[model samples]
Target: MKAELDLARAFALEEDGVTAIEYGLLAGLIAISIIAGATAIGGGLNQFFTGVGNWFSGITVP
Candidate 1:
């Protein structure tokens, strides 16, 4: 009976599960931010490159 009570008390005081969950949430947020930043940068780069291509196409050499 004493061993069971002690085990129950220890289980109640454990924080490993809570710590793991917090870390997981932090990782997920970081991943989301990185994805969003990359997408925005990619869009800007695509537009810039397209404009450059248009300018080059308009050039004519005699």
Candidate 2:
């Protein structure tokens, strides 16, 4: 019984659990920010590059 209680106490270490959760949340936030920024700028960047390519193709720059 004492061993079981000790094991439970170890498992219940609040600092470890909190740290794990904090890191997980931080990673999640970072990933979401990357996705959001990519989505917001992806199309415009692609369009600008495509336009530049067309401009260099001796065709009118649209």
Candidate 3:
């Protein structure tokens, strides 16, 4: 019975599962942040370039 208790205690302290879960969560958060940042920047930059290209198109009407 004592050996069984020792084995159970060892199992409880095992770090492999906890480490993997932490790494997985970190990776997921990083991916979400990157996507969010790109979307925030992409919309504004797209419009700025579109207007610039139009300005140089020489299609203005007086």
Compare the candidates by lDDT and give the number of the best one: 1
- Candidate 3 wrong stretches, greater than 4 Å: 59-62
* TM-score between candidate 1 and the true structure: 0.86
RMSD of each: 1.2, 4.5, 2.9
Query: Number of clashes in model 3?
Result: 0
Regions of candidate 1 where Cα sits further than 4 Å from its true position = none
What is candidate 3's TM-score against the reference?
Answer: 0.83
Give the better candidate number (2 or 3) by TM-score: 3
Residue pairs with colliding backbones in model 3 are none
TM-score for each candidate, following the candidate numbering: 0.86, 0.60, 0.83
- Report the lDDT tens digits of candidate 1 across residue range 1-62: 99999999999999999999999999999999999999999999999999999999999998
Ranking of predictions according to lDDT: 1, 3, 2
Model 3, 1-62: lDDT tens per residue?
99999999999999999999999999999999999999999999999999999888967777
lDDT (tens digit, per residue) of candidate 2 on 1-62 = 99999999988875877989999999999999999999989989999999999888886665
Q: Sort by TM-score, best first.
A: 1, 3, 2
